[model samples]
Target: MAYQCDLGNNQTVYLDNSGSQTIVTTASGSPGQQQQSSNSFETGAWTAPPEMYRTPGGVTLKIQAQGGDRWIQIQGQSSNLSDASSIPLQEVSQVPGSSQQPMQPMQPMQPMQPMQPMQPMQPMQPMKMGNMEMNNNPMEMRMGNMEMRMGSSPQNTGSQRRFCSQCGSPVQPSDRFCGNCGHKLS
Candidate 1:
């Protein structure tokens, strides 16, 4: 058997005991904007009086047996004690053929498929910078108009070289001043 009560502001609460478990459902909002939440308890859980039930959405229900009759009081987060007592809870039975169907048990989840292995990365190719090409060979390097060979040093075809005392830069032997820093060379 199911008993329903209407709360103000388009909200209705239903207590259903037709199945093995007892379910308390709260439905609110208008036709297209209706929102519902249900909380289930063991069938004999409500046999004792002054039982408190709290929904997942924070709605509190106080059920008590008074004068051989059951009474339910709903208290939402925003509702004050005075407002909760003002709303009368009347029990209404479900129509003969319009009772709600019991909820079905959830099915077991399927196992996930195995993932494919990743492909190996390809080897890196030679890189080219502005007018310069760099390869895996470390003995050779080429830039703009210059080429350097790592294995051998170039032979100097000029006379003995002189260095600037102030900047330590190599200067021409015949130069009177350092070409790099303009320092006078003896």
Candidate 2:
């Protein structure tokens, strides 16, 4: 025997519309004015870096607002943001134990892939010493007694010191060595 259905049967399916809210805004904060964490991104100074990733339409991020500190966890098997501050790279389905997530935007699945380790920046050039030939800058070069003059008078680094080349008694600036006795006193 076949059962007969009533023609007046009315069904009103209730669909949950939760994705309408995407942008989360905290109370208008006074930026760095409010005192909380010593180094909490400077409040208003807290900005996403250049290399940041964004979640997809169906995926959602969970944020826990602690006492001024926001603790976040990457939850969502298939949805993974590589850089939420710099480069936005969407992780592929290679995440481990990534099962079919719910198509609801309001419900975000737990992240399957672990956070990627941060890489160090590379140096521009190799570290190596150059020549020792001092330049005109007296600040870099140091003499035994004679201190190079800057813009005005030539001041001696040490007082009661002979010239670079002492001859017999006092070596003159013009004479490289002493006329009577040649002596290197530089």
Candidate 3:
């Protein structure tokens, strides 16, 4: 039998029973790293504390496991675990007050510039058909039980239009094959 519990942020603790023995494993992923710990013990009558588990980030697990033939093992730098994992890697290099001799003096900060507002784009006027100018409206027509939708084609040089035979979707003039339905434009 195997059981697993999440300690948050991809960290997990797992318990597995193998014959007469059981193995408990804990894995935690700190800000920039990952670490795992495991313990093995025989299944026997033993006493356990009210809280028996601890994660790498000092976030305590309220588990109780007392006495048994328990063998515990911890891996990775304990100092790293005690510290906040969220600390940026760039900050790790420079200590707060630690004075290391600098090769050069720091440069002065530059002044900020005022922001300019953007101008809105002008709307496009629709093309004229015959003597009447057509408004910017969607073209809609019907043929028997089918509804026909139309739009201006930039690629089509002539008034002729093409469609996909499989799905009956419009096909571009420049394209040799159907773009929508994948059917060959014959």
Candidate 4:
């Protein structure tokens, strides 16, 4: 069984009973600058009162045993062992034959399957403009008598092409009325 006593100002005392021997440890200071000291002795050593133990840093612990209970008092403070500032040390372990159960192990996870490849996209249908049809891939437009193909070819420079202002369809230079919508051309 193990017992602990907290003496405020970042200092604590621990007592562990290991059958024939008893271990006493004193720990002080903050987390990054901590200092600890421990001493072990026969369990019969604490059978009497006023037993003094000094730490490495010059702090002293005054231990007393009374009525089958052990009490601790820090030196340089108060000499009274039963005062309110004094703390009693006793066993802190769980009682025997408790109903608490142990934890179980976790199971392994299954592996994932790879994703299937995506299908290729289908080609789009040609769009219709007044009386013309336009193929978007190569940029070819066809109307009544004029057909315009836009690309790196020099035969279709697009300078001789004329379009109706109203219907936006290709028209010849000599035509007076648009063939697609019959709109008057200037």
Best-matching candidate per TM-score: 1
Q: Rank the candidates by lDDT, best first.
A: 4, 1, 3, 2
Candidate 3 accuracy as lDDT:
0.49
Candidate 1 Cα deviation (angstroms), residue 104:
5.7
Which pairs of residues collide in model 1? none
Candidate 4, lDDT over the whole model: 0.60
lDDT per residue (tens digit) for residues 19-111 in model 2 = 221122112125454221111122222122111223452222322222232322222343545433322333233222222454656677777
Candidate 3 global TM-score: 0.24
- TM-score for all predictions? 0.38, 0.14, 0.24, 0.31
lDDT of each: 0.58, 0.31, 0.49, 0.60
Off by over 4 Å in 1: 18-20, 30-32, 43-72, 76-116, 127-186
Per-residue C-alpha lDDT of model 4 across residues 1-186, encoded as one tens digit per residue: 466666668987776544445567777888689877776655444454333444332334453333344434344543433333334555556322221344566788889899899986554689887898887556677776676777635354446677898988888778899999999999
**Rank list by TM-score:** 1, 4, 3, 2
Question: In model 4, where is the ten-residue run with the lowest total lDDT?
Answer: 94-103
Clashes of each: 0, 18, 5, 0
Give candidate 3 misplaced runs (Cα > 4 Å): 44-186
Error of 1 at 116 (Å): 4.3
